[model samples]
Target: MGIRTKLKRNRTQKKGMPPGSLVYIGDEQTEEVTVSAIAFDSHGMEEFEDVSIDKIKTLIDSDQVAWINVNGVHNVQLVDQISKKLGLHPLTTEDILNTDHRPKIDFFEDHLLSIVKMLDLSAESTDLDIEQVSFILMENTVVTFQEKRGDLFDPVRLQLQESKGRIRKSGADFLYYSLLDVIFDQYLIIMDEMDDRIAELEGMIMEDPDNHSLQDINQYKNTILQLKKTVWPVREVVNKLINRKVPYIKEDISFYLQDIHDHIVQANDMVETSRGQLYGLLDVYYSSLSMKMNEIMKVLTIVSTIFIPLTFIAGIYGMNFTNMPELSWDWSYPAVWIVMIIITGLMLVYFKRKNWF
Candidate 1:
């Protein structure tokens, strides 16, 4: 899912680059940025592919609703130009370039900016993958940037194109909410995947505890911890948005943000639940080891009990030959064998009655 961290500042660009240059926030070998402009209103929708910054500028003035989606963050100049055209703050642009930002909301004089993480589970390995997505909401337009070319926003795009919901009639803030909702939905999917894995590990531990299962549980526990680190901050960010009266955010959209807040709470709850399950699994593993030790001890104790009487008879016979009468008896060897068998049998019976096995 194109997981990325904060990019190093490109100090080398100082040779000719402007002071507020848009420094790419990720891997430099990224593909060219792909821009798609979707202009929609109550009446209809129009989509423009591979649109240039000039075209975007022209569309920004249109009364129809517009969404500009940029697929890559590698072209600093283009991003800088867009920021200038939209009157976005330089700090906001810098945050956009700093990919390590936690989920947050910033209220600018003319717009609202949101930073969020998108999660995906690796298909080959059950690893949780994440990417950073930044949203800039203006009067009638919403601009979104991603660290990579692929995303989970296809469903939202389809909805907008089909005019399937209130998205078409709503302002850019609603559109922002829709995008956030999709990202949160992806979070839920990730949580479900983790939950399924936790359940599977539980079954495996219960059936037979082993080192492999312990490692698997620990790996998943670490993944859950990482997810919690990303999501818990998101809850606080959303809470801040919900509590404050932001100018760009519409009052009607507060309820939607509240819903997102509730989802964050649920995500936090799932993390806690997964943590408890991991602890339980560790306890079960230890208990299994203890039980195995007890079984081995039981067998050794039984063998010692059976040999005790036999050892006593042998000790008596080994005394000075002149004093040992049984050693000279004609049937002495057979009598010793019989006595040993009787003692072993009685011990076995006692053990069976006591249900030690």
Candidate 2:
């Protein structure tokens, strides 16, 4: 089963609910809250430690670029407070709480709202763990929300800290792009691993077809199908962002979004390729099994052929009614042995000549 079905979201809001309604969209268990802020402009950058909600407002109004990263989304009160302060719409808030949503981008009056699934492949089992991350991008500020704190944004943070690229000079839109780029890059890595696994399984199936190998191939096919469900929608989401004009997206940065769109295309292509490879694997498995069965039948037929005449000779000797001329002869036992040996040798030679063994 896909993770979406297993980790489905429960709606807490009523129908016709007003905008900005507070609802929690994560697991029931709550944990400690952690907030980190990075405020940067063309000239310099500052990292704030242990910042409170009140302190966040101070940076939101500044002309300098700012990025507010909230690690935990379990606190409804904190999430509500941030929504109220920033004047975010209720629908946007609802999406943040509804973590089961596919990747999407929505345009608001002053910001562009983007939602994406972050994937982590288990090193031990090669299974996938998916999480949802939401982004709210404005002109000078960007806010990111995740279910828990981990390495999802570590690459983006490193880029900011080292000023490795033009991240420091870029606006919040570029920061938004950076975060998405990192997430999609992870997807590529996971796809590569999946490709390797499929290739290995293909080799095993060709070498030996067994019940275990068939089961493994089916499991891999299921995994790839589930992954396709997530990736296809994401491609459409990015495509919408690239073609549609939104206030938050600058004209200059449209190309960057287009680049992300291209990555989505690449991911989709890999998914299709994986599907084809799996089908080819199934074909190979069936053919190998058929070949093995034919070999076993051939050996059984040869054994049965060699035993038929020997069984007949024994039967004739056992039916002693004194009327059997050969049984009455003085050298009958030795002659019967010689005849049996000759028959067996002839059958063996014929089988060898026919290439049946």
Best by TM-score: 2
lDDT of each: 0.81, 0.83
TM-score of each: 0.84, 0.89
lDDT of 1 by residue, 275-354 (tens): 88888878887788678778889999999888988899878877767877777789999998898899899999999999
RMSD of each: 3.9, 2.8
Q: Write the per-residue lDDT of candidate 2 for residues 1-357, one digit (tens) a residue.
A: 343333444353334566656676556545776888999876778999777888789888998888998877778788777876777887788778777777888887888788888888887765777778889888788988888878578888888888878898888889998888888888788899999998988888888889998898888888788689878889878888888887767899888888888888888899899989999988999999999899999999888898899899989899877778887789999998899999999999999998988
Clashes of 1: 0
lDDT of predicted model 2: 0.83
